[model samples]
Target chain A: MKKRYLAGAAIAAAAALALAGCAGTAGGGSSSSTKTLTLAEAQKATSADDFGGMDGLVAAANAEGHLNVITLPPSWANYGQIIQGFEKKYPKIKINSANPDGSSADEVAAAKAQKGQSTAPDVFDIGTAVMNQNLDLFAPYKVQSWNDIPADYKDADGLWYYDYTGLMSVGYDTKKFPNGVKKIDDLLGSDFKNSVAIKGDPTQANEAASAVYMAALQSGGSADDIQPGIDFFQKLKQSGNFLSTLPTQATVASGETPVVIQWSFNNVAWGPAAGSAGNPNWKTVVLPGAGLGSYYNQTINADAPNPAAARLWEEYIYTPAVQNLYLAAGAYPAQLAAMEKAKTVDAATLSKVGAAPKDFVQLTADQATKAASLLSAKWAAAVG
Target chain B: MTALASNHGAGATPRRRGARPPRRPGTGWIGLIPFSVYAILFLGIPAVLAIASGFFTSAGAFTISNFSAFGDPVILKDLVGSLGLSAASAILGAVIGALVCYAMLGMNPDGWLRTIVDSASSVLAQFGGVMLAFAFIATVGNQGLIIVIAKQLFGDSALSSPIYTVPGLTLVYLYFEIPLMVLTFMPALEALKPAWGEAVATLGGSRWTYWRQVGFPILAPAFFGCMILLFANAFSSFATAAALISQGGIWPLDIQRALTSETVVGHENEAGVIALGMIVVMVVLMSAYGVLQRRAARWGS
Candidate 1:
């Protein structure tokens, strides 16, 4: 009888704790009593219109008090400043950024694994390839500046939208190639023997895939057909100029891989990082006539535990101030066209990054998917 | 031969009957609860889930088509490459580790040298993944320290560097494999009783004759079992090779490519199929190891 009493008491205590958890997530702070929209309503909000206006949305989000973000490395494209800028603009909310070095796929997996929990990521910044495959996982929330975004750069329903992109460029040790590589085919020369490398396997990584697509453009293959890119790599390998090593700052500094093909922003960023590491004379060049650009997409997790804060974060990042941060890091923002037209872009930062390539190609969703499949089918055979 | 046969018979029967009491059936199983729970949670459930996913399509419909990944020439090549690498590393590791064990046979167990070797083996066997890959890169990579020295002595063409290739990977695998071999094969080496040598000498046998007739028979199973264990260790290893090789040159890397490819969708279940294949390979290897272990144990006691 005494054991049964203890068991019953334990069950009651567990039930109380469970209820407390639900209450904590749903409504905790004193300000939540004045919240116009419930957490459920905020989760379904497609725009601030659902909360009457942006001010109402702000109040609801402030009540929530916490936002969960994943896979946004602070160093990438000046996210560190953007995050700090958001915190300064919204002091009431605390942003929790987890797994800052995780990949796009890892972001999706974490969201799925932590679905309804308060710790679940409320937002995602993922590559377009992964974003296309996981449309159903995102909430269709349009920011207040949604109309300024290009029609082709976002989903019709605002499920996901382009954030920033960098032109695919070649970064090399200036000591090795004094004249600099003026064209993609320069990598095939004898001086570059066993020296050229991409960021990762083209079949898997976004940056490496973009590098191949850039090669495809130069080799007379369209975005829908990337076979020429494979042939180009095979030819380079045959000439003993293609290295399979994944190039990092350390490897570049050590001269293990003298030339790396990746994003212009990344390579430009590497000029400073690798200089500090050892090698001081690093240079990046966006080869003319073959500029390929790809953008990462941002979206709200459909099952966000802090839904109001997720929407508020969307509003925060899309602002002109935050978009200019991408320029400072040598990347072109999705709103570059709009900001240029409105004369709101940061001109000094834009000049430093140089002009966006006049004749660059950004593959549509369908084109990228087709290109990806082709790469998956043929990459290992071509370069294995 | 007659003396050895008599000794074996005398050693086997009476001890089997008298040494071990019949385990109390139900209560004795209580000790296995924690292990059983751990296995079920970590191993058994994940294995079942992974293998089951291989038989299903992405939309949850049942299908066997996912197994077709094995038929891909690329996958077949990866499998062959992985198996050959594992075999090479395992055989070399076993031989070198066995030699180390042989060298240590006459050492005092509590001596500083033996203690350091034992502790180092225990630590180095667990040292792998990114740290090991970085160490090798810093030591023998294209522009590494040894390569720089060699380049100065002999022209650049004298030595073809192998730091990022399969040969280099095999050499790296041996770093830990040799140590593991010492830790595992030492017991069987120590099990060689001094009395057995004395008995052989008394029977007018030479040292080589005693080894050929007795020592080889007793130690062969244990040696092969440890070699198989090392093979499994190399087979399942991923991070070290992944850190070194960018492309999918092995089974685990292939699985990594299938699952995490940013552009490839609807092929995630192929990772499960590949995992199932690995499990099948492990099951066969472990079964052989079990049989070898039982045989070795019989002789050991």
Candidate 2:
């Protein structure tokens, strides 16, 4: 009975503690309450990825010097370089960007944690797909060059814009395919069995996945319809050209893999000649016909902590001066006017970039949802 | 009660024979000082903020929209996935840990072998997040060592496709979590002293009977506590999942929506709803588990 009493008394005490917990502190300090307007976004506001020239937005916030850019952990390595550039170019604007390990989830949490002026990420970079989910959180700030962005790339609401684009092009074994394996439909054979590699299942990324979708579109079937992609992979798999890894371009160049399907820049990054020196024969080609093109975009938060700098950032990135950096970095430009005067890509390179990707099909939310569903089903059916 | 009495006599009663020591008034609650501060800073305050933020708007007005986000399919799916994964990991940890402890208690090898096995628990217990995911990938992804070996040895076409599969994730969770369970259970299992089981057996008790009568009574509470720790540990797995979730497209939902989502749009509030749902489910399961454990403890005693 005494033991029972002790146990019961303990239970009561715990309950009281629970009730106390539920009641919580009637008042906590500003630490619980400050609204740090988070900008969990990339730099569309910077006018360009290169931060070309937007002195108006960067010049000391017009003497107020109030822009704290948190390029915190996981912000890509390039972002660090860009942030340094942003700071140097606009030192008067108090642009503070912390490092963050760039992941979609981290980007989202940074936004969520900063619910208001105190804790909000004023703006941040995110992928084209997730930009819309964050649409409500973002306030609209259209740039002067918004009209110049391809009609296909910019959202109707001006929530996000494609900063630059890449495509799922092939980097072939130039030694093996001396005849120049040129077209999209060329790799459909038994000869290249168990020979190709993908970074992930095509469906994992828009660039690679969009290639499959483009294949379907080229063969017959729009974005909402993706049977051709499924069939294409099915044929590739049957031929044994389906590899998950290491029959990659690196593998191919090393004679492990003969053909690799990868991004345009990736092919450039893997250039045997580009690496240090003395490495041989790393070359790439955009497919002859309209290739599978996808864009990695820059989005500015609507409720950016440094709204003026954000707008200035938008202006700076789209200019011809800064866009050359992207060209050097290996991506196509959004500005046609800039492209017209671009001394960046020479005649030989211009022909390879494939005539400025004639058909630009951006995915609408409903369209994307349906496309994801359809493509996903096709991917599973073919791969499984 | 009799054993405790003997223990009291064996130990210093501290009250009789002038053995009593005066309380240092300041140190009476000294042990709880760190706990008090830690609780407020990490747990108490964050929880209050999480709850309060759920009800209040940007302008500080109360609204049902926060709650409404809970009904969303994507949020619901994430909540279900989180709970399912956590529960599965916990169960796997428990079962695997229990078996490991059983092996340790009465197995083939002894001495250094046992020590090696014992140390393994601690080694694996320390791994989490990206390191853990990468380790699993190295072991199991399409480009993993095992897959490479399987292909080389068994003609390259094996089960080399778990890079982003659900089973692949569970396999990773099991790797670290089972080791953690063994670490947690080692002491509790060790406390089930061999002498007690022998004594119970001498009283004509069967193996099951001995376990039911004496062995279980001591370990029950500790087992439940360990399981609870495992549950909570696996509950908020954001980094590891994010690193490995290739095209599965499921991501960990957290805090609030100062961030934007790409896959599912126009649903920032859904994160709060998911968080709240997780809290509810966790609370319910923990409460049920607690009550069941209490009943088990009562019966064991």
Candidate 3:
């Protein structure tokens, strides 16, 4: 039901762009006349074909000499290695990654605030709901591998596309709970008293919000409804089982939060980090039920200071090599199915992380918007 | 007297009608230009923009609707929480700081005790935000030193404290607030002349009478003024509270929510609205502080 709304909205947006005739080109206000013309052309180009070829795009991006990316932490989904690779590949273009710990909302805000400046973000790696609301801020540009990405995961007009995804999972201290819970209901027992924590504030953090949605699905609610999740948390709080502190590697190691609900990738990353922090008994497991998956989308800023560099970045990350980096980091890349079919994916990493969940549930853009509004209205009153 | 008379005579010499007086030596205020520009650029412009944003909608259209956030029950509750917390910390800090200042009166001016305490007060007053919060957390948090010690000494049913609660937050705020109070209030204490006490004694007044008639009366305005400054200090603090607590239970956290809420769309202006509230309170208290400082300065020189 929610998928239909997303498809309809994407179609409508594409049609509106078509009716406008020309591609939207928000100007880069930081350079000289010649550079401005180059940036303008880069902003208007929808694909490498428009610039003649990938070689032409690379030259144009080298001329720009800089790329601004935001909300991309080095440790997230093996972005540290991916960034180093991009820098090694394009030595001329300096990648300025700003506010690496900022949120998806903060990325949009920075793009809007720094639109015309040299410090403006050239690309955004943001969550779906924030991407949906700020669609106008993006310039439609397709990568060479646009065909490989699933149609449902990318905007019809190439304004935004999914980059990487992860499933929701339960991470726990093995010493405290040697026999991990087989079900969500096990957390409600006395043994888990005042020990259960979420990743962060549900109304702000994507991981925490996904935890709620995962609980809602397990409690018999659909993607369009998130009230049951709030109710579940409220029940957890009333039973003195819910710990208000956000669960982090430090908290997990210190036994402050014995159990946490967060993204599977984060939990997987924490296993080694927590071990070094003295708690070698950390364990993560995908719950035995319907899996909830969420993905962060990538988009080019319409007013990118280095438009050519932005386009090059989008092209670079979507390649098979970069996508494999995400896979190795316990995340399922956007082009996983295509890579698997073509045998381009790294098989060893695939076997280690297990096959991607084919039937994992996701919130459509419209469903995400609805769920966000619902959480904003009821989360505090319910859980507080 | 001769210099004044000669200056008057020179000024009285028939000058051109509407001509300006001669510039006085050492009265050149041009040196203040850099500071003025710095204040206007960094402090003035951002403040104006933040306040002006509250009057506009997300679409950039002028509207008064954003101020409606003030009427929100949650906002009001948080405002009350902020007020109570600030008042508690500031009042306690001021009283304790004043006593410490009073105790310093008996010490020799050049002695090690006064020198060490004054220097320590200056440094400790600036120690706040995440570092200060971490200090308290390591000392008294869930797995902190004191708690671990208590558990070891008295077993499981022993001294578990509310180090994560509102009370705990007040205690953390006072860690810096008291030191700041000492730094600000000590100058007024040092301004007291010994001759005033000697005059009171010569007139057959006791030490209590001298303090009641002379010391308390003069320090009253400065005392209350420092307390107000301390209130404003705690009221506008965000980082210390943010580091200690995840949820919004006070005014600054409400601003943080408005600025960073991922679920709620187009409410960033409410941060400005909350900020405007803080500005109004600060402006009122600072005006009173200005007047009180003027009164306090009379005895200093």
Candidate 4:
């Protein structure tokens, strides 16, 4: 009796394992069928193309019922509010956001790696250089408010458009440097010894590259030439003023990195938080005469799992209400100028973001590509 | 011959001389099926893919330029840097760990102190990466606890030095390397027989002479083997260095850049080539280790 029971148990276990394997294969097979919406139909659609205009797009998106977004940290540009607001507005569509803290490179990598799968990202928030390099991966779909986006910020083919801009600024602990660094040239002073830090490798990080570009502009170099910036950093390293470290809030508060060169959005968001942590004198200053602005672009995946939902997301982000949400988070929305002109922007939010600098220069895609390659080839050796 | 003799003595028995016994069902070679499947799925396939990709371009065309990039000065510098760091840490860990093992040998092996030390060494040998980096930062970073204490006591910036530089990284690498050394080198230390010491003494050899001749020669192979392991461990380490160093210029860091950099074209194959280079280095060291371990095994048998 005992032997018979053991034999039966073994057979049952084997059957269960076989069933589990079959279930996994079946589950994987079903995901491909879930992509009922087509990329071609979505790309061609405008307000004129559809009967209900934006409402029809929303209806079509609701039918699709899901969106896969990637590399959106909640804290980044107030993505938390944007995502929450989006979901609350469109209760029918569920957003499956992957890798909240992942980098721009990670977003590109995921789109490439998971090309045909349901888990593939439908939207990307990436740097301009990265977006330009992987142009083939993005689909051409102009949002309803496409004309409002600046001419310099959008692709000619409607593949990608700028979402928000971050101006390069210096964030410093005021307790350490009572005089404060108001300009890029001020960083070279004797008071900032072994204190200054950039965000990360300029070759990889967009903010760090922009910081270098801002430094170049201040030190008599054009956007076409980043050599002066590299030279400046080398000089700083030679003078024992530049720390080859990535700065964080903790590092700034601890005096390990008393001064940091990063995006205005990041500095503005984190400066007050760092001050509240212990030091109450943290401040961020936009360098005078060096107001360089770089924007992160948004693109829909060419092979997005939910085509209608992805288009809907792009449409939602370009609206005046959402643009104000970005402004409130310390980022200059790509549609800020247009919204202000239309008197659609929230006055309170605009006042809080402060006045836009008149001479802020945006890099062309070609210039950005060239500068990125230059930095990749030269930054390491120059800094070291 | 014995079976044949037994058969002969039995006379007229049906059992034939030198005939094999019946094998058990579901045993013998069949037992290795699961392990073979595992090896093929995990190790064999990935290694084959890594090598195959190294010889191919991103467009699937064959190219040798991937391997050719190994000769580039920047790549060569990174490779040398990795080698130097690994060698320095491994040699330092091995020497210090051997000393520690010798000290442990003098203690009662079954004691609570021995038990605690052994357990701690095992746990610490596996400790590294992000947590270890954060731990060091909290304890010895620019505004770390020790630094703050030093500043208060001495009125000088004694320990305010940056802990993210190359030398600092070497110190971090040693945190696990020394304990790993203790774990790997202890058995070899225990393998040293007290009888050999007595024999050397009986032969009128001094303790110093015994150690220089018999002791050093016997332990040399195992020491070298452990050092090679430590070297491979340090060479292939990624997370600790990645977490600490922001601007990566080391071998693993360069490999990371090649694999992940958006601006650099044709780096996918280069990443495979760099990986292949690391495998070659590790294989060479492990081959040396295999030979030494085999030699050491002779003494055990």
Residue-wise C-alpha lDDT for candidate 4, range A127-151, written one tens digit per residue? 7666766788888888878899989
When summed lDDT is taken over every stretch of 10 residues in candidate 4 chain A, the lowest stretch is A27-36
Error of 4 at A115 (Å): 1.1
lDDT of 4 at B163: 63
lDDT of 4 at B150: 82
lDDT (Cα, tens digit) per residue for candidate 4, span B21-138: 8776755888889868877776668667877888998768999988876876667877877888889888999899889999999999999988888999888887887788888888
Model 3 chain A: weakest 10-residue lDDT segment is: A25-34
DockQ, per model, reads: 0.40, 0.10, 0.20, 0.25
Question: If both were scored by DockQ, which would come out higher, candidate 3 or candidate 4?
Answer: 4
**Candidate 2, residues B1-301: lDDT per residue as tens digits?**
1121112212211112335577666866989898688767866675666656666654467776877655545445545666677778888888888788878877544688788987887788757766886676667665567777887887735334454544456777887778777776665566556777788778888999988877777677656656665666677565576556533323252332222323333334444555566567556656655564454434232
> Residue by residue across A1-384, what tens digits does model 3's lDDT show?
122334534643554344243223223233221233365777888998776678777777776677778878665777778899999999977777676767788888878876776667899888877776778999999999999999988989999999999888888888878879788878888777667888667777777889999999888887988888888888887887877666666777787667888877777667763347535777878887888998889899999877888999999999999999999878899999999999999999999889999798898877888898788767766765
The prediction achieving the highest DockQ against the true structure is 1
How do all the candidates rank in terms of TM-score, highest first?
Answer: 1, 4, 3, 2
Chain A alone, TM-score per model:
0.87, 0.66, 0.86, 0.82
User: Model 4's CAPRI class?
Assistant: acceptable
lDDT computed for candidate 1: 0.80
Q: Can you tell me the DockQ of model 4?
A: 0.25
* Top TM-score model: 1
- Candidate 1, residue B245: CA error in Å? 1.4
**Candidate 3, position A312, lDDT:** 94
lDDT of 4 at B241: 77
